[model samples]
Target: MIRLSRIPHQLLTWGIPMGPLMLLRTRGRHSGLLRTVPIATLRHDGHHWLVSPFGDTHWVRNLRADARAELGRGHRFRPVRLVEVDDDRKLEILHAYRGAFGLVPFVRDAFDADAGAEPHVFAREAHRHPAFLIQPAG
Candidate 1:
């Protein structure tokens, strides 16, 4: 199962250009080396919200250590700083993500937003998802 998940991520990280798929570059939390991960990103109302479909994953930790990361799509890349969204906003963003992406299993499964769930269902645990508001890095 992990292998299956890795293939697409590997493709997006190095070899594909499909939709809004993006490559996020962050410094390794422990190694202090650069690490890249492909992420399915969603943007709304001029704000880019990054969802950690897989919970508070590695890249999330890396960002915690250093709030700056580079967002890359196709050939364009921009440096951005992560401003951790508060729980209230996280729930709202998660709702937007669910509606836009059709309840991604990785996220819905964790937040229990499957089928007919209220948009605010994720509120109680929104902090666990670790969403961020992106801003141009200074």
Candidate 2:
């Protein structure tokens, strides 16, 4: 979904200091073509996870169809497996994100704007959105 070439320089500019940038290579559900995206990451307890602020994007759908993906951080490439969080864990992750980033209000407002609904309702739906924990393959 994100144009990699256009943002490569900018991505590296911001990615260098704020932890490793994630490159997720996934297969298109309909077209069966491979798609890659660079995303921000949060590492929790040795596991890497991605939080979808805009929930259910094309890349997320690709991961759902095929859990196996290639992750590139800087020049290292590693194989990762996607683990989708359940409802309870998703809530926990959301809270953890809010606490760690201290961006609760911004997150809430963003979800509201994206969903075009009231903050309360959109917040609830955002919590239900699927998030993935990426584990390095053994």
Candidate 3:
């Protein structure tokens, strides 16, 4: 399934619109080299938001190991410091993600929230998933 996702990942990163797609480049925790993965992201407020989709995946682990990462879309790239958000703000970001993509089932199942649930409902289950606040690495 992941291998197949990479096919569309390449297409969306290069051939199609990048409005919802991005490349997350993290320094491999063990290998000490760059590792890039395509992710669906939403930019809200002043931060770029990314959900694990799957819980505590490799990329999430890698970024947690090293907050120095880059987010890219086609020709554009930005150095970002990833901070796991654990406040009311995270729910706001999560709500924006649902509103933007209507990826409710995907998110709900991943985070163990009910369909059409409120942000507060999901917020209670926040520890199951990680939402990052992408800040300009300055």
Winner by TM-score = 1
Model 1 misplacement above 4 A = 13-15, 73-76
- Of candidate 3, the 10-residue stretch with the lowest lDDT total is 106-115
Q: Write the per-residue lDDT of candidate 3 for residues 14-129, one digit (tens) a residue.
A: 74665677788899999999888888787898667887757688899998899889888566678989888877887777666666666545554565554466778767666766
Number of residue pairs clashing in candidate 1, backbone atoms closer than 3 angstroms, sequence gap of 3 or more or interchain: 0
Superposition error at 39 for model 3 (Å): 1.1
Estimate the TM-score for candidate 3: 0.82
| Candidate 3: residue 24 Cα off by (Å) | 0.6
At residue 19, what lDDT does model 2 achieve?
47
lDDT of 2 by residue, 55-92 (tens): 77888888888888877745556788888886556655
Q: Lowest lDDT 10-mer window, candidate 1?
A: 107-116
Off by over 4 Å in 3: 12-16, 104-108
Q: What is the C-alpha RMSD of each candidate to the true structure, in Å?
A: 2.3, 5.3, 2.4
Q: Which candidate would rank higher by lDDT, 1 or 2?
A: 1
By the lDDT metric, which is better: model 2 or model 3? 3
